[model samples]
Target chain A: MSSEYDTTETLDVKGQSCPMPIVKTKQAIDGLEAGNVLEVVATDSGSISDIQGWADGTDGVELLEQVEGDDLYTHYVKKTE
Target chain B: MSTDNPTTSVDDADSEVDAAELQALRERVEELEASMAAVDDGDDQQKMTIVATQGSFDMAYPPLILASTAAAFGWEVIVFHTFWGLDILHEEKSQDLKLSAVGNPNMPMPNALAALPGMDAMATKMMQKKIDENGTATIEELIDVSLESGVDLQACQMTIELMEYDEDDFYDGVTTGVGAATAIQHMAESDVQLLV
Candidate 1:
């Protein structure tokens, strides 16, 4: 499913906990240009909801796809504006 | 019969208009109260203040962690350090802050083992190691993050005078050195206050 969208950059925050994943994701997303996709891979189970909720609250970033693989959670966010 | 009398009928009409006006005024007061309540609620939801009074390794983490996390949530966060807590802001003193296993019910080791001569140091090292292994940010790193995220770090002026410490003893990013009165004022205005 990752092959569907073009990813501009990938951030692997595998061992990080709750807010770190969200914080790093926010930082990574901020560094991207408009319309660029950021692929985030995190091991924290909380990231599934955390990233979704963060994207929901954030204005410019859109959560495109979220996939769960065994112990890893992958989120694709595109900078919309 | 009253309706048939012109004077009584005029009086009834006048009373009806007065009642309608009274009802409109009541609704207006209710709307004003609701709007004022909303303004107060907004004021209460945006600011938080935390006071740190301990300098141990375990004690240092809470304020830094909370301040950084709260700032990330777009809150106006202030962390005031007084007494021993001021040690956490000092580069040399911060490294010497140790976790004591003695009398700590939550310590993993039994009392007898924890009472050993070197147990406190051992516990401190073990805890630091575990924190690093968990990829949790160090106190210094969290302090930097909190400052970068706009969490105001303050020192107690009275404590500095009492302890005979100068401003040079503390690291950068301490923007203010204030008295307890100032800290109390901030706490009174803040929506949330925590002492750790």
Candidate 2:
């Protein structure tokens, strides 16, 4: 799926379960500079809410967009200072 | 007459109102200070401490799962292994941790099948396979991930001493051997504390 926002990096966490996807996503986002967009693609069904909740709880990160495709979910997040 | 002092009466009323307002402001300040103090006490909302007391394959997952997940959330996670739970931290014994199907209510089959001679081994293999198929990290992998993410892994000193197990018996990531007091300190500091 296409994201309106330009992503600086894409983290593919496909086939990973609940916490692993979130964990890897967090780690991936941590490496990027502020204002960079991270596109996290995952097959875990729970990643939809998990990523949203993670973004909500975390500071300096904003959920820009979410795209759901067949058996896959992509989360677009922008890191803010 | 006192009624003639109208300005004085007005001033007196104004002063009484001022006094009440001052009291209310003081009370509000005190309440805010109390809450701030509570927050400063390090209720450790961003920290988690888990006590792992069981070593079975079924039992080993909880602490590792929680510790890793908590670390994933950017929380400071600590897992304290005591007694049988230390087996998960042991280099060799960890591989031997087995799931017993005989009395497990969650086992699909009847007790007759579960009671078969080698069923425990079968159940353990099944459990491990299911964990692998589900994309869940193994206990060893979880421990490694947790450590790499800065989760603190501690062994119970009392148990280690009682068991006569050397520190070499545990995996590389086991950071410290601490007594109940240290574990209790972690629990007290953590907002999310679990005994598994």
Candidate 3:
């Protein structure tokens, strides 16, 4: 069975540092249509907190599922209008 | 024909004018150099001034971190907050700003390493303390350093209305209702422009 919040977009932000990841992710969010979802994978430790903070601050962006593994972070966030 | 004269000269009028202009520029440069050397040799510990622009809470740290540390190193540092970054201009709100991590699992935060079950709150508090220890200078310290070193701090007026924050919500060094044009002008005057 597929997860409820499936990945509609994938952003690879590896090896990049703080602010760049957030900046790029914000661009992604802007491009996304409401009700869609995005799967984000990153190696930066700051992205987790930054993305969550951004997702909370805006409307129609819902972080639906989160799974943290050994070396990276995987998140599925749905777009909500 | 070969126009191969190595020192091909200009006409007398143009050559005379160019020579005079060059001489004047050279003399002015020498005077400037002497003044700079005097300032450098003297005990006047002021010259460089920087204006920092911080728009968000997360965006707040880099500017403060850089400015306070720059101040510690004896460079004049100013932090200008326009929008959400101004939230930290107040001692109370600044101390309480936390990162929300439910869907944003990619904030490049060190707390992600703690990935313990429900460790986000702990991670956030720890992050705050870490930032403090890292000379992630507080808004209060920024104000103090700014005052001591003649640094000017201003808040963007338009951002104030967008966020519905009042002037009374800021610290003593904080000036509210400044326009972006002013900040842009300051940034233009600065040798560096960081968008944090």
Winner on DockQ between 1 and 3 is: 1
How high a TM-score does candidate 1 get? 0.73
lDDT of 3: 0.62
Error of 1 at B122 (Å): 0.1
Q: State the local distance difference test value for candidate 2.
A: 0.85
Best by TM-score: 2
- Those runs of model 1 whose alpha carbons end farther than 4 Å from true positions after fitting are A1-8, A32-37, A52-65, A77-81, B1-45
Superposed on all Cα atoms, model 2 deviates from the true structure by an RMSD in Å of: 6.2
Instruction: Compose the digit string of candidate 2's lDDT tens values, residues B84-173.
Output: 998888888888899989878899989899999999999999988988898877777777777888888898988888888899998887
User: Candidate 2: where is the Cα deviation over 4 Å?
Assistant: B1-45
| Model 1 complex DockQ against the native | 0.27
Candidate 3, A13: how far from true, in Å?
37
lDDT of 3 by residue, A1-81 (tens): 135665678887666555445545655766888877888777677667867876765456787876677767767777787
Kept native contacts, as fractions per model, are: 0.30, 0.43, 0.00
CAPRI band for model 1: acceptable
TM-score for candidate 3, please give it: 0.45
Candidate 3: lDDT of B10?
46
**lDDT per residue (tens digit) for residues B28-48 in model 3:** 999999999998755433323
Sort order, lDDT high to low: 2, 1, 3
